[model samples]
Target: MTDKIRGSIGPDGPPWPVDLLADLHAGVLEPNRAADVRARVGDDPEARAVLAALDAVRTDLGALRDAPAPPMPDHLAARLDAALAEEARRAFGGAPSRPRPPRPAGRR
Candidate 1:
């Protein structure tokens, strides 16, 4: 269970969204919805195969051991942090900070 979403090809329609199948596979979908998808997969060979393939991939991916995450490059990390801060400020309707004007020498 990585947070990856799995998609499914519907019997006659376009593919269903990833979360629908992922939730069903994870047993998190409401029982009725899970049963509906299960029934559809059971009734249609192509749909069943699609579900199986997605399941297989999920199983394979889950079996992989996680490697230690390396440190982010300082430059990239700084840029990312700055971008996120800017985005948050904008989201909260805050303007960017302005530099203060230089004071005259006579002013203590």
Candidate 2:
């Protein structure tokens, strides 16, 4: 079958595979990503509309990102921490603590 007939069309060109979409979703979840997406909201009316929709999505995701990350009630954090500690111990044979990589300078 032809590419178009096979539903391979996308706005820019060919369709994106599921894995690519997942990776993109993860990247957009990063801190300050909403601001980055907002910066793309441009001058053209059509682009502005698209940007507006993106802005709505960004807002929802921002809410999710900003939601209370503190320990939940009923000592849930302790339970979770213990469970994760056990898993990490089993998986790595020790407490798992990975260093956060430094953010890039002025790359945002």
User: Model 2 over residues 31-65: C-alpha lDDT tens digits?
Assistant: 56434433433333544554455568888989999
How many clashes in each structure?
A: 0, 0
Q: Across residues 2-108, which tens digit of lDDT does each residue of candidate 1 receive?
A: 32333344422335444555566779977987887777556556456666878898878876746555566655655666787778779987786443344444332
Sliding window of 10 residues with minimal summed lDDT for model 2:
11-20
Best by lDDT: 1
Model 2: how far residue 54 lies from native, Å: 1.2
lDDT of each: 0.61, 0.48
lDDT of residue 71 for candidate 1: 64
- State how far residue 35 of model 2 sits from its true place (Å): 20
lDDT of 1 at 108: 23
Give the TM-score of each candidate: 0.40, 0.29
User: Candidate 2 — which residues are off by over 4 angstroms?
Assistant: 1-50, 63-67, 85-108
The numbered model that scores best in TM-score is: 1
